[model samples]
Target: MKPIYKRIVLKLSGEALAGEKGLGIDTNTIMRIAKEVKTIQKMGVEIAIVVGGGNFWRGVSAKEMDRTTSDHMGMLGTVMNALALQDALEKLDVITRVQSAIDMKQIAEPYIRRRAIRHLEKKRIVIFAAGTGNPYFSTDTTAALRAAEIEAQVILVGKKGVDGIYDSDPKLNRLAKKFETLNYIDILNLGLKIMDSTATSLCMDNKIPLVVFGIDEPNNIIDVINGKKIGTHVKED
Candidate 1:
């Protein structure tokens, strides 16, 4: 099937990589994701990833430390996740490059927009780590910012538990309504927390579409790329 999107920014929460343990890297899950990504790579999709650090550290949750320090720690955690993913993808013979928002020359190359785009052009999967290189920003914002920089057609948000965006938390409310498609205004007016307001605003202003889908289902990423409508699509009205 011809892909509807040539390039995509995959937003993966650190918790998604944790599996049942809910903390640290789950090698099996990472490898599984790597294999899934390998399939997409062969489809000729330019893939760029923005991974969260929630599995290791969440800045907002750590009240004892300074917020900036906590956020920096969270960013470092994302770098760890990035390295683990790079290792798994390389094992599958998939060429990968990790670029960090923060300067981490020993591990990842510093994030350079031109270099990142060039990497994607060469069919190398680029994993963007360290949430915007600043505190008070979520990985969701990193995804939005990177997507804009790379000019990705869509952002595929691979969620952990819930399949799609609902009026209420699916895990909390049994009667929550699932939206098939929604505009940015609806997301803001309805107060849906699929992503932070900053990130949502960025996508809205840029007119980039987002697909909120469950990663649990096999081939869901590829399905999204093929425009299968397996999840909630957020776009302009």
Candidate 2:
């Protein structure tokens, strides 16, 4: 089936890449994700990915370290994840590029809006790493920012465990309600933890639609791009 959006930004957390171990990259898990990505790429979709580095480091969790230093470390972790993902995709014969916000010219191209767009237009998968080239901003915000820059039609978020947005923590409350659809204001007013408020506000202001779905299912990404309703949908309306 044809994809609903010609261009999309895929947001992946580092924990998602770690699989059940939740510590470091899992070779098998990354391979599985890479294969899924290949399936979608073959459908002529322009894909840009924003990956988090929680598996390697989390700036917010560093109580004794300087916030800037910790966040910078987190940024480097994202770069590592990006390289691994690039390798996996290349092994599958998929053309891919890693663009780093904090440039290390030897390994990745510096974050260039036009160049990134060009890569997508050429049917290349672009992985964005380093969390917006600044400290404190989460990768979710990076996804929103890049999607706007690239004029992507949607932001598809593949969550590690939970399937969709909930009224409360589903893990803590089994009876928590799942929202099939939500307006941007609802997310803000209700204080849902789907994405940080900065990220949510950015998407809201730019009128970008977001799909939050569980990445555990093999076809979740494909299904989401195909317009299947398997998760919470957030938009202006």
Candidate 3:
């Protein structure tokens, strides 16, 4: 089936691949993600990914240490996750490329917008890493920045906790209201957990669609790519 968006940026939470271990990458989890990505790749969707490194380290968790130093270390952690995901994707026979925001030429290409778009055009999945190559920025911002630069039709978010956008944290609040559709302003107004405010604002300004789905579901990525009704849709109304 043809995907709803021809070109899409996939935002994955690092914790999703932890598989209850919460330490490092889980091979079975990675394979599941890769297989899902492979299924979509075969549908001819140009894919780009921005993965968070929360499974390894969180920037806020490093605040007790030197702030800048800790943040840089966090960026490196993201690169680690990126490479891990890239390896998984390739093992699934999917052509993949890793681009780092920071200059890590020996391991991966520095993120050059045109080069990344070119990779997408060639049907190679591009994995973006290093969290904007700067401290004080979240991977959510990186996803927004890259999505805007590459002009992706939408950002398909694979969130670890809580499936869709909710009035409250579904994991904590059993009575929370889940939304099937929300406008960008609605997210801001209702405080939806789609993306960070910065990310939400950026996508809102650019009119980029954001879909939040549960990554715990095995075939959810493929379902999203095939335009299955699997998550909350955040768009400009």
Q: How many collisions per candidate? A: 0, 0, 0
TM-score of each: 0.98, 0.99, 0.96
Compared with the true structure, the alpha-carbon lDDT of candidate 1 equals 0.93
The superposed Cα distance between candidate 2 and the true structure at residue 149, in angstroms, equals: 0.5
What would the per-residue lDDT of candidate 1 be over residues 139-232, giving only the tens digit for each residue? Answer: 9999999999999999999999989999999888999889999998898898999999999999999999999999877788888888797889
Steric clash count of candidate 2: 0
Candidate 3 has a TM-score of 0.96
lDDT string, candidate 3, 27-96, tens digits: 8898889888888888888999998888888886874798788888888888899999899988878889
Model 1, TM vs. native: 0.98
Per-model CA lDDT versus the true structure: 0.93, 0.95, 0.88
Query: Where is model 1 poorest over a 10-residue stretch in terms of lDDT?
Result: 216-225
Q: Which lDDT tens digits does candidate 2 get at residues 165-230? A: 999999999999999999999999999989999999999999999999999888899999888989
Off by over 4 Å in 3: none
Question: Which pairs clash inside model 2?
Answer: none
On lDDT, the leading prediction is 2
Index of the highest-TM-score prediction: 2
